[model samples]
Target: MQLGIDQDQADANSRITAIRAAVLLTRSMELWRRERLDPETVLINLAVIAITSERLMRGGLDPKHNSLDVYLPLEKLQGCNVASIAAATGLNRETVRRRVKSLTSAGSLIRTASGDLALPPDKVQERSAQELVRRQLEALVRFANESLRDGVLMLSDEKG
Candidate 1:
């Protein structure tokens, strides 16, 4: 009788452990879903950065003119030559120099020279916006593929 009771207790404990693990796994998935950033917002920011860098490279605007016309309304412009970009974009003289360096480092913008920092035109939209959209979609496809693969593996494990 004691042996039977011992086996039952062990079975119950095993079941409890499995339930806790399953709950943890579910919570992790929920967190990942909740933390996903909006892709459209990310794409817009990237577009602004790319366009600004392209402008600087092609010399559409002088780096010593106005920086705010370019950098202020954009996201993530650090690690660049701000005085130069400020001259072009019309951005704040002080902020331009400081933020430009940081933006360039973060890949949001690029500098054409040590002194000039206008964005290149190609980065913005030279021919058609469709091309830009296509490139962005391609990147999203790759991201989705990786996520789907992980989801499938998780689903299979749960069933087995």
Candidate 2:
């Protein structure tokens, strides 16, 4: 097998990325399990967070509110619905609905008048959540460094 770095090695990149992603997901599940969070619930929460992040990247958000200490205002978020979450995550709609209901009741997630769901500011501000983000980020950084060293991607040589 060709182990040396190849810049055009799309297959190698896919395999490496999948491995790194699984490690992150497993570590996250372990942390969530210790917190008594169901894996499915955690997965659903991740989908919601991912959707919110996409909006942030698109700009027009007031950054002050979208911090670890606070979440974007419901009105300022496109948010996510159970059906949408299920669609995006490829999870069963009923499963997403059940978890969303439970999370809302437990105050882990907030529900808006538009039937959209979001992670609450209080949840984001939790010490455990902060710790989780830190550890996960560290793992991601390692993955990035490894990928770069393996030539999975690179900084543009050309000036933009």
List CA RMSD, all candidates: 19.1, 4.6
Per residue, candidate 1 scores C-alpha lDDT tens digits across 45-118 of: 33445545564456554554343323332222233344444454555667655555555575545555443343
Q: Which ten residues in a row have the lowest lDDT in candidate 2?
A: 1-10
Which candidate leads the pack in TM-score? 2
Candidate 2 residue-wise lDDT at 131 = 85
Q: How displaced is residue 83 in candidate 2, in Å?
A: 0.8
TM-score of every model versus the real structure: 0.24, 0.78
Error of 1 at 134 (Å): 13
For candidate 1, the lDDT comes to 0.43
> For each candidate, what is the lDDT?
0.43, 0.76
Candidate 2 C-alpha lDDT tens digits along 1-160: 2233345754667887678768876876787677777778778888898886677778755767656777546676676888889988899999888888888898888887787788886777888888888887887777667776767756554544
Judge candidate 2 at residue 99 and give its lDDT.
Answer: 82
Model 2, 12: alpha-carbon shift in Å?
5.5
Error of 2 at 104 (Å): 1.6
